[model samples]
Target: MRYIFFFFFVLLTLSGCNKHEEPSSNLIVSSFKLPPKNESAASSDAKDEMAAPASPEIPQKIIKEASLRFETDNLEDTFNRIQSAVTLNKATIQNDSEGKDYNNIYRNLTIRVPSQNFDAFINAISKGVSYFERKDISSQNVTEQYIDLTSRLNTKRKLEERYLQILQKATKISEILEIEKQISTIREEIEAKQGQLKYLESRVSESTVTIEFYKTIAQKEGVKTSYGSKIWAAIQSGFYSLSEFLISIISVWPFIIVFCIFAYFIRKRFKRKKK
Candidate 1:
């Protein structure tokens, strides 16, 4: 009876101790205490501010491009002038080509310049040019596109950080793999957005200009075709016609011979009748 009573008392004491101590789940909950009403309201405001980020000031981004085609009497002089302008504007010549067409000897240049000096370079090139066969200037605004890419990139970076944090806390290999996959996807998106942003920046920073100038062939040689050329062409045409006639005659030589023999017999018959 004494042993049973001691066992019952020990069991009761253990149960009381368990009731006094906090459970694992409640201990976790108690670690983070609720703030007062005023503090809570301030925290909520802070969260609202964080959730809605302020819009960044976006300077206007413009891509400028121009193309000009004209006629120049002296190619060397005009090219020298353009080179001077290019030097003054700190421009780079991407491509320089000279070719002769049917009626003109032309030179084409592709130039890249700083966007800030685009106008100055254009004006410098236009100083001595009296006429242009074609002149085109275009401007494109990419501010919105740039801002969008930047925002998306930032968001992806934040998402990747969150994924990394989750990966650290993960215990199972499957969970880790899944989190890593998500991180990889987010990283790819971030890289792509960064690339787009870089492209936009490059375009905005640099401008492209294409210039084509040509000297007309008529200035050097007034006549397109001389009388001798016309005579030669006519002779060539006559020779070609003669060649075609010979080909036609040879194409049906047997039929031609047959017709000739029949005509000869008929003529002889007529002559005999006449006699």
Candidate 2:
């Protein structure tokens, strides 16, 4: 009976161990069955995000301008020299004007040159200049404005694209018309922005230099007149006045002839009455 009981206890112990071992084995199998696809997908997404390119840096934009006034000894010579300097610096003359006052000769020039050569061109023209009456240099930073325009243009284009897509999918006439109207408005805005951007780019790429140069005449150096020359001039002036008076009389010849005829008729009538 004791041996039987001991054997029975040993069998119970073995059954308990089997029960515990079975579940652990099943747990191991279940753990292996969990899918690795989720982890792989997450890793792939991370790689894609990391591999994406970043936005490019924006270039700097600046507009430059200058104004200068100079006094020159010789107007024509200085103008020619300025022209030569412009040609050497690959600049363009946008406007040019020359005039003479009572005692001074002056020239105004508006020149445009590449921004990169702005300083050099200015220096080149300043070489022979002894003094400047006025000098002004200005710079405007347009990078922020440029970037803002670019971003707005991009946004407008995207909005236009979205409108087009909506138009394609629209079934009602009202919806289609509304989409078209929105697209038109967006397109107009885009064009205006584009034009503004182009203008800004042009200003940034080229620098403006306005120049006003003049030469003065000395009063003491004026031509001196002799007495004989003055007398001759007076005689010429009197003769010119007499000629002008004669011309005025000739211009009224028809009226003068009519008046003479009326006077003769009156005198004839008076003689008839006396007879």
Give a tens-digit lDDT track for model 2, residues 1-275. Answer: 99999999999999999999999988888886542365345344444543475768888898999999999998888988999989988999999998989989899999999999999989988998998889899999999999888867766676677568879999999988887987898899999999999999999999999999998987755555456678899999999999999999999999999999999999999999999
If candidate 2 were superposed on the true structure by all CA atoms, what would the RMSD be? Answer: 11.0
Mark the 10 consecutive residues where model 2 has the least summed lDDT. 34-43
TM-score of each: 0.64, 0.67
Tell me the spans in candidate 1 whose CA falls farther than 4 Å from its real position. 1-61, 75-80, 87-90, 95-108, 133-148, 216-226, 243-258
lDDT of 1 by residue, 10-89 (tens): 99999998887768668889899764365346445444544597766778999999999999999999999999999999
Q: lDDT scores for all predictions? A: 0.87, 0.87
Q: What is every candidate's alpha-carbon RMSD to the true fold?
A: 11.0, 11.0
